[model samples]
Target: MGASGSARPAPFLRIAQLLRDRVTSGMWSVGDQLPSRAALSAEFGVGDNVVRRAQEALIEEGLLEGRAGSGTFVRAPRERRVLRRTVSGTTSPAPAGFTGTWEARSIAKVPAGPETAFRLGIGDDGMCVLTTYEFFTDSRPVLLATSWEPMAVTGGSAVVLPEGGPLAGAGVITRMRHLGIAITRVVEVPRPIRLNRDQAHLLGLATGAQATFIERTHYADGRAVETADWVVPSELWDITYTIAAPPPGT
Candidate 1:
């Protein structure tokens, strides 16, 4: 607590995060002038030195750019990612030389993350079965898939079930057919994301490599049944969605 009876940030880290959030949220736009040092100290209830340290940290993090005569300004936003997602009744089999292809890798039961829960419409007690398989085309390594299946529909049997069940297949349609479930609709959410070390190792690429991220959802009786995140190396894979045209006379 300072003289004004206000609590200050723990040290430089809290201040750094505060500034980062502001910049990320567009509260401080690019080329925008920063508050004066004295004003910042007053607002944060910290000393001038502490404010300076926070400013320096932001500059180092590339969140702010300092001008010789003028004050610091927020950095520009990073480039956006272009993603493509598609859903179809039929899916091609994995290319030659792959052990299990895309869908045969299903194995252990794992907890679903927040996004998975929301997509699958399940609560904390909901369990998800996750599996991953690396794929190749023409003797060159390519896509990596991390698929999730909700336990409610599978009656927890899917979690302990081995990979070589009747569910193994490229398209969810085939799996649904084997499970005796009729798929009513399919949804695909496309996103752009960089490959992490684990994913890179699986895909035979370097960490931080550019990749197209795609999440395709399969629905049964209007309920989101399963979701799969497909990661493809920049040069190895491509996805195209075919949107139907308008009616003949309209």
Candidate 2:
């Protein structure tokens, strides 16, 4: 809330979003000249000053640029690459044609955060094995993952530490299977969010950049054996989901 205390943004902010939508929707393209502010003002039924403020906002977001005499043009187009997602389970490497590598740190006996505890069906004070991952393709970071597995499920077992022991680098599916736990289903929910300072730093992006947040949980015996938060930069990657089909009719 600002001085006005109205929850709604100003006219300029709304106008700016409309302009950005055109570029992102491919109705406008890189290097394409935008309609003059006066023209847009007439179309939007707003004052030219409001239009200018809107354009300035888009420029700050790197979506457009203003020329001294040539007027405004679309500077950057929202181009995103595809990242394949399979239902089989992820905690692994990137797909073929791309080399994916990640650095992970596992901390044991850590208290679970509220969200983590809820996802794992445990109390807030429950102990969990938290593993944070920084996944990259080549030298460019693409994805971030933070997994929390209830120690009640893996503690005192060979798979206590997700990144250690004989099962080092082995994903949740394999590790849980070795412990005789059959993961029958996986559920993922996606959310749109802005990058925090730390996440933006690792992804080489500016703070408040757009990203996709995925809450993925693996279920075994109707219990959430492992739950993870995966972050993907919207500026770079588009998530593609691949669903496997059954072989024959029952």
- In terms of lDDT, which candidate is strongest? 2
Estimate the lDDT of model 1. Answer: 0.64
lDDT of 1 by residue, 140-213 (tens): 34677777878666644432342545543545566555567888877766778877867755554445667778
Best by TM-score: 2
Evaluate candidate 1 by giving its C-alpha RMSD to the native, one decimal: 13.4
Summed backbone clashes in each candidate are 0, 0
- Per-model TM-score on C-alpha atoms: 0.55, 0.66
The lDDT values for all models are 0.64, 0.81
Candidate 1 residue-wise lDDT at 1: 50
Q: Model 2, range 1-250, lDDT digits (tens) per residue?
A: 5476558889999999999899889999898999888899999999999998788667547687665557788875444578776645444423323356878899999999788888989999999998998887655576898999999999999889887888888788888988999889988899999888688667655567789998889899789999988898887787888888788984
Candidate 2 has what TM-score? Answer: 0.66
lDDT of 2 at 243: 81
